[model samples]
Target: MEIEIATIGGYEEVGRQMTAVRAGDDIVVFDMGLNLSKVLIHDDVRTEQMHSLDLIDMGAIPDDRVMSDLQGDVKAIVPTHGHLDHIGAISKLAHRYDAPIVAAPFTIELVKDEIQDENKFNTENDLVTMEAGETMPIGDSGELDLEFVNVTHSIIDAINPVLHTPEGAVVYGLDKRMDHTPVIGDPIDMDRFREIGREGEGVLCYIEDCTNANKKGRTPSESVARDRLKDVMYSLEDYDGGIVATTFSSHIARVKSLVEFARDIGRKPILLGRSMEKYSGAASRMDGVDFPDVEMYGRRQGIERTFQRIMNEGKGNFLPVVTGHQGEPRAMLTRMGRAETPYELDEGDKVIFSATVIPEPTNEGQRYQSENLLGMQGARIYDDVHVSGHLSREGHYQMLQALQPQNVIPAHQNMKGFSGYVELAGNQGYKLGRDLHVTTNGNVIQLVEE
Candidate 1:
């Protein structure tokens, strides 16, 4: 049996993740994502007119040209989660190949919403939904089996897929952490991973996330963040001003915690911004989680009216949950900081950022500007009351020990993060470029029979 793997994108960078695995005559693609930095830089003026090829040229999306020769052999497109970096490009690129798009329900809903927003939904591209813990056969001859192993992450319905091929099992272990005490969904399926490692043909290759490899010890659980948020909110119970909290819109568990705490403190929880509405609606539709008591405003005019009402009712009576945790220039929190909203920031008002700045230059600049604007209005700023969703060094070590694959490939990182992963893997007795593969995008590694 011949099996080859190619890194289409997200090798030396942190976004636009796409990987192609070819087993004999059939090929299965994992994740058609986008590089947000590139998209922000290049697609600012003519975003509407930018085609798939244009995005590829600007590095906004994956350059599938690497798979031109094997396009006809492609069987399926699988996405692991609903993050924009993981599912944003599917609407633009899925039409290129004659295959169905498969993912968990929440992810599929997010993809569908993207297609509708872009007006690019084609009848030819079908969507197939697979719940976590279910296994399905792909390809015309059913030569490959795809299993979705449930895992906990920032988003609900996240999974680590294991592709059972004729040669062996190939595991895609990216964008997830081992969170046993998740706030909303089930914990990581440790038993299933161990079974795959010890049973059957065993894991031949493991492609893992190295985003947080520089950090030592296991990444803290979402429950930890929940506790931190509770402490922050409870401490402000006596403060007589509006409380504004912001985080990633797709972080449903975080949203749930915030909403619950807001309601518990007798404050009305209001969700603002288009993304906040889209992701929360998708989560509710998938039966993942629901915030029936929280009022959400998606349109600009509606959000304006909502803010006006909050102002009239007194800021201390309501909690505003908004976007712009990364300080996107157009997001609601930035607009609020700029005093564009009808509601004014009062002295000693709290603006809590339940997120960390993603260490990118653009994000750093934007976040600084936003914070400056809020600080000028006498709003007290609290930041980084959250935990990351990716695995740290100890988390990676535990995963390696559980899976115990023959070869390890560090993915979803730049050189710094990958180097950290290399050092950690070395401690486990795996050498670089031999049993461990550290490669850049577009590089192919052919696995030989042992």
Candidate 2:
């Protein structure tokens, strides 16, 4: 049997993550994603109507033409999570592959929604639902098995797909944090990971997301952010003025916290925006998900109507959890800042930004402008009441200790961004150009050959 890996996308940057593992004649592709920053840099780019080739040319999606270089049939298109950077391109590119789009239940539901909204492509790939801690056979090869190891991320239903092969376990270790006390789901399955390290052939190759590898200390648990959020909302309890909050609409746990705390602080929580309705609605409808029943407005008319109601009923009685934590021009928060919506920001009103500024030129500039606009309107801003979804240096060291893979590949960042991980792995006895592979997009690494 032969084992090979392809770094298709997201090797040199944080978004548009796609990778493939070939076990002999059977290949499994993971995460056909989109580079959101690329899309954000342009004006009015409707990705739903764009061609795959053009999006590739614009660096908005993975250039999957390199898939032809891998001499194996694609057995499964497994997405690790539901984030756009992990599953956005599925609607655009999955039509080219014959494999089923396998993922966790929530992720599968999100993929269905993505496919339904797509206009340029008709992706009819079978959406298979596989929960965490479950395994499915891959291709016709009895020696290959695909397993989903539950991992905690900002979003629920996140997993790290592991391809169990005759050579060893090819662990697709992308976007995740060491969260033991997550708010909505089980903690990061470190016990399972430690077991995988000591079992079978032991992890042959570990591909990691180096998004926060440069930061010191482990990433804080979601529970920490939850506590901070609770404290902030409670402190604003006696205030009679309006309070508006915004976060990553896909962050269900954080949204849940906001909703719960809003009621605790004597306010009705209203979810406003298209993505707010999309993600939270999906979570609310899922089985075993105990999300609160709250009001959500996704359409332009409905959102405007809801804004009018919030103002008429007195803004102090409601908390509007909206989109545009990064200050996107048309998002609910930005429109509120611009006074374009029916909801008005009065003097001394609070705006809680429960997300960090995304480290990109477009995001920084937009966020700065949005904050200044809000400030000019006398809106008091509260920022960074959140924790990152990626692991830091200590967390990376812990993963290397647990997986103890024969080979390590740093991913999800640029060469300079991978430095902290490189230094950490070197302490664990992994070397560059040897077992530690620092690769780029559209490259292949042969770990085993017949």
Best by lDDT: 2
lDDT of 2 by residue, 1-450 (tens): 899999999988888999999999999999999888888767789999888999999998898888899898998999999999999999999999999999999999899999999999889899999999999899887899999999989899999999999888989998899998889889889988899898999999999999898898889999999999999999999999999999999999999999999999999999999999999999888853556678988999999999999889999999999999988877888888898999889899999999998766678898999999999899999999999998989899888889889999999988889998999899999999999999999999999999
Residue 157 error for model 2, in Å?
A: 0.7
Model 2 ranges off by over 4 Å: none
Clashing pairs in 1: none
The residue pairs found clashing in candidate 2 are none
lDDT of 1 by residue, 211-294 (tens): 899998889999999999999998888877889999999999999999988887878899999999999988887788978867
Task: State TM-scores per candidate.
Answer: 0.97, 0.98
Model 2 compared with the native: what TM-score? 0.98
In terms of lDDT, model 2 sits at 0.92
Predicted structure with the largest TM-score when compared to the true one: 2
